[model samples]
Target: MKLRDELNNREGYQEIIEFYTSSINEYEQEIELLLEYEKKGIQKYSNPNLEIIKSTKEELRNAYYKILKSMYSKGDTIEGILAIYLKLISYFTETWKKSNGYVQMLEMLSIGIMLKIGDKDFKLLIEAVKKDDPQDLLIDTLISYRDENWKQLSGKLMWNKPYKALQEVIFLAKEDKNLSLERLHKYLKKEWFRGAVEIQTHKSKFNIHSGYWSFESGALVKILELDDATLKDQQYYPYDMVHYKE
Candidate 1:
């Protein structure tokens, strides 16, 4: 495993991992406290306070996802990365059930699919994604992998962004595998990092600069079963994750 050169500060990355770990623990403890209060029939921490509990759990899962990305940036083993990913999924599923198909981030849906989660979990992801109404063809195409009858979603994405590259790659995948690979290579080189300036520049306390990964690209590769020989070295392609095996 090699550390992403973009994340040059190994010490800073470790610090981020530690910070999120601590934040996750705090959020967990806060949830436990909230539950205890609810169980005791406290007026303020009544059923209505479930929203607070839900929010805390959301924060906890966000921290877990951050750790997963940071650990990958730190060059952790695939097994280790998968372990944290599974934990995050478990948390996500619990919250989704409670919130009636809530999805915290659209990107997470693609990541979960590419990770090769079980069919039942994938179904939950599909439902949550549909509920979120992503309105993007790329996400709809992704869902079409599981539900072949899934209709094409309607909307236009801002063409100037990096996602346009991904959208082109997805369209090309249906026509020419070679062309798709070429487009994906171009995406990794030019468009990927340019789209995420905040993380690249480390502008905020919340941004905990993790490794840059194009999970959508990884998902498309897995779905299309494309030869990623040319993409293995691409900066944001997440090649190992696309090829990860249990």
Candidate 2:
């Protein structure tokens, strides 16, 4: 089948195409205004020490949301919404890579896309991002989403099977003061699909002590290093464990 025919055969695909085609001028206008604000920020804050003003950041965010809502209201699927968001991010980031507020704008826009897409659509969203983004935006966005979800989980880990065994380790740490990296590796190998490699790599990528995952809530929690000499210190010395709310 032809590509156009293939796309048209998908439910809601033609509507999404029509929506973007009709709204191209509007999208361009918003993007142009947003880029103007970004350029102004770059000129205003020549010194690397200085940050973009809050108002300028808010303007960029508003422009992004305006376009986002437009596409969302057109009744596209979550995958379609993600495609729209990625295109916008790609366009804006390429246009203003050095703009003081560019990364901040992308961060805000990406998170909003995830939340709007919701946890139930995470797999579809990630796949769309992986397919479209070449600059590792999906990796950054997923880490951010997972971190936010962790905070919402409080000390309780997600109850899904992938995390269930890890939760047992968390429970043990709560009961016994701390958990060593070795012990975490053991449970991760047993339970997590990607096992220890996935989390250890994430630890470095996110600049955290160790581990990152998300849950139903919208906040992120970080695992921190803990050591109590009285309890007994392993070779790793301090253990990595879930941070308590207190």
Candidate 3:
């Protein structure tokens, strides 16, 4: 594995890695403490605050996701990245009961497909998503992966710019490979990072920066078997994961 040029030799890479590592450890310890409180039937004032446990788990998974990205930026092996991803998926499966948000669900499913996770893990991903409304085109697209059916629902997309742009890529993927590739290219170049506050500025105040990647774009390429020859070098497109075998 090679370090992503964007992150290679960049200042604060080690600090970012250390920050994520420490955050992951802190979240783990917090989960343990919460579990102990639950076991002992402790309460904060009158409320048991069990919801905090679930929220803490969400934070833990997020930390894992960041570490996975940091590992990639730091030139970690594929196996190492996959290991962290598996932990993320497992934790998500165990804790996540409903759709966190549209973007979050999309990113999770996309990364799962891009990684070519095992059938069991993939099914868990599907099950987690089954909690969302069936009318959602994103949910429909995600379910299509398991059913091996592609649904054309471009007419049903909402007017939200970023969401619509991403949904277009997935829908076009099944109809026209070339157009899908073009839309993906356009999304990566313009729409993808429109509201991404995390990486908007060149420098980070807390060393939380990690490589930017469009796992969903890679997932579309993997699911539809679209040739990404032209997209391989596009900024934010995770080309290596798209072509990763075994």
On TM-score, the candidate that comes out on top is 1
In candidate 2, which residue ranges exceed 4 Å CA deviation? 1-23, 26-65, 72-76, 97-246
Q: Rate the local accuracy (lDDT) of all candidates.
A: 0.71, 0.37, 0.70
Query: Under the 3 Å rule for N, CA and C atoms, how many clashes does model 1 have?
Result: 0
Query: What is the TM-score ranking, best to worst?
Result: 1, 3, 2
Question: Which stretches of model 1 miss by more than 4 angstroms?
Answer: 43-48, 93-106, 149-160, 202-207
Q: Could you tell me the TM-score of candidate 2?
A: 0.24
- Model 1, residue 213: what's the lDDT? 75
Q: Candidate 3 on 1-246: residue-level lDDT in tens? A: 456636434455556667878988887887788778788888643545577767777787777877787787766767788888888887776566443455556677877776777878888877776554435566566557755643533345433556577677777877887898888788888887774333543365556667777677777777677788988778778777766773
Q: Assess candidate 3 and give its lDDT.
A: 0.70
Per residue, candidate 2 scores C-alpha lDDT tens digits across 36-154 of 76767544345331233334333443444334433443333445545555545534433332224332333333444334544434444333333444233223333444346422223
The predicted structure with the larger TM-score, 2 or 3, is 3
Query: Lowest-lDDT window of 10 residues in candidate 2?
Result: 211-220
Q: Could you give me the TM-score of model 3 versus the true structure?
A: 0.81
Q: What is the C-alpha local distance difference test score of candidate 2? A: 0.37
